[model samples]
Target: MTEPVLCPADPAPVTLIGPPLAPGPLVFLGDHAGALIPRSLGTLGVGEADRRRHIALDIGIGQLGRLLAEHFGATFVSQTYSRLVVDCNRAPFSPGAMPEVSDGTAIPGNTDLAETVRADRVAAIHEPYHQAIADLLAGRRAAGLPTILVALHSFTPVYAGKARPWQAGVIHGGPGSDYGRRVLAGLQGVQDLTVGDNLPYAFDDTDYTIPRHAFPNALQWLEIEIRQDLLGTPDQVAEVARWLAPVLRDAMEG
Candidate 1:
């Protein structure tokens, strides 16, 4: 028999912010928005310090996504569990989805995970999160409303002791990443901003959200990454959103 993924007591896997029928053509997603683990998982045996790290969640994306959605009058969908439990951005059953180790830090909870446990995580977390996104977009399409999908994320300023220079990055892949490139150009036009075009990382084999919801539908989309340091406080979060919201608006309009 297949084991269940989440306990009956676990919180909902996805959080939908803003109105379902918001004004804008944008739908923002934060795959690693929260760092909360199920009470049963017990932090995946990780320490509090590591639990708060990037391996657990995208440091400030929850706030960032919320702010952008509010400013743009767009619908925002986010995962409220830690990526360490099951990365929503990755394909189910993929190694990166439930990484045993991330950026050289060992995840004790992930080690030697049983097949049943892995499947449970996917059933509980990954499946629901993606389903929410897919359903939201489908509803929009059925209503004949224009849609632009944007995935929000934050990256650690330094990884494995190596410092990264760009303040922000835009990840695009394949021929379908035209909207991503336009977002790159829009942000680049901002003054005093060092924006990387597919720097630090690129959208590739490990990405599931965009491929599953955006590309196949041929939706204009972008996966945006902000340096975690820039999102250290509420003011910082607003500052980034203030500049970024308009950039995205122009990208969609242009």
Candidate 2:
């Protein structure tokens, strides 16, 4: 028998903030909101500095998601484990899901992992987080409520020594991303704000959450990425959230 990836004392794989409100069009997701590695993993052979970096999780997204959930009175579903353990946003079969190296940093514990060990992480963390999202969406559908899924994420200002120019990015593609395009256009119109229309990263086969949940339901969805530097402090996060709330609202009504 395999050892459990998460012990009873550990946090749940999924952290749900706010309750689902009927007829509410928003359901937010923070796939890399946390930086927790299971107690069993013991840091995955990563140093403290590296663990605090974007490779471990999406910086400031937890605060941002919570604030957004409060503002919109919508459910925010978030993953609690660090991406280094098992990237919830990547398919379990993808090598990038449990990377041996990320952005030049070596993950010694993940190097040459056994299939069973990998499966344990997938079953423990990846499955439950997504299942919660699916279950919520299903309940909303049964109640005849409309849903507009929004995936929140953050990226490092510089990747592999190259500086990223976009202050924020909106990713939209596939068959069900009409709403995403609208959001993208809306953000682009904002003065003095550099918004990327699928810049930093594009929505593609490598992505898991949005495609898995949104595509099948033909749901309106937007994957938004904010540069980590802009989200460093509490005031900055609040300011960004305040600025973005109207943009999302306008996109929905437009």
Candidate 3:
């Protein structure tokens, strides 16, 4: 018998906040929101401190996503498993989907994996998380509702001994990314904020979420990356949501 990646006691792979068919064009995604590891995974051979680090999850995204969802009255779908187990934003079985090393820290559990093990991670966590998003989008499309997919993420202020200068970043690509450009411009207009235009990362073939759900559907999409340090407290998260919500609302309406 094949062992399951998620036991019965494990948390559900996807956490959806707000109505699936909420009255709006915005849909928020927290692809790396949680830091939960399956009981079966045994911490993936990572120490406690490392498990709480950015490698395990995108810090503060869960709270921020929920706040944004409530503010916009849009659906917020988030992954509940650690990205160290299976990065839901990457294609299944891709190197990044189950990284062996992240930011120079080795992932012992991911170093040598049988194909079946990798498949189980995808089947249990990655598939369900994305399927929920897909199903919600399909339903919205069937209902003739316009959709704007916004992926929320957080990055460490420092990576591999180097400090990042940007307060946030907006990643967009392809011919259908006009909304993303508008968001970038809006963020740039914010006073005392340094926003990167795809500096920390870019939208490319390695990305699976937007390309998988947004591209073929031709939905306007934007992937926002905030510096993790800025989200260290509840007040900080709320402040971000406050400023960001208006920018997104204006971008969508403009």
- Can you write out model 3's per-residue Cα lDDT over 193-237, one digit (the tens) per residue? 999999688888988899889988999999999999999999999
| TM-score of every candidate relative to the true structure | 0.96, 0.98, 0.98
Cα distance off (Å), candidate 3, residue 10: 0.7
Clashing residue pairs, backbone N/CA/C < 3 A, model 2 = none
Can you write out model 1's per-residue Cα lDDT over 1-254, one digit (the tens) per residue? 65355678878999999987775888999999989998778778888999899999999999999998888888889898999999998888888888999987899889988888898888888898988998898888888888888899999999878999999999998746777898999989999999988998987788888888887898888899999999999999999999998889888867
- How many pairs collide in each candidate, listed in order? 1, 0, 0
Once model 1 is optimally superposed onto the true structure by TM-score, how far is the C-alpha of residue 172 displaced, in angstroms? Answer: 1.3
Off by over 4 Å in 2: none
Off by over 4 Å in 3: none
Scanning candidate 2 in windows of ten residues, the lowest lDDT window is 15-24
Which parts of model 1 are misplaced by more than 4 Å? 1-5
The number of clashing residue pairs in model 1 is 1
- Kindly report the root-mean-square deviation of model 2 from the true structure over all alpha carbons: 1.0
10 residues in a row with least lDDT, candidate 3:
1-10
| TM-score between candidate 1 and the true structure | 0.96
Which pairs clash in model 1?
5-120
| Sequence-dependent TM-score of model 3 | 0.98
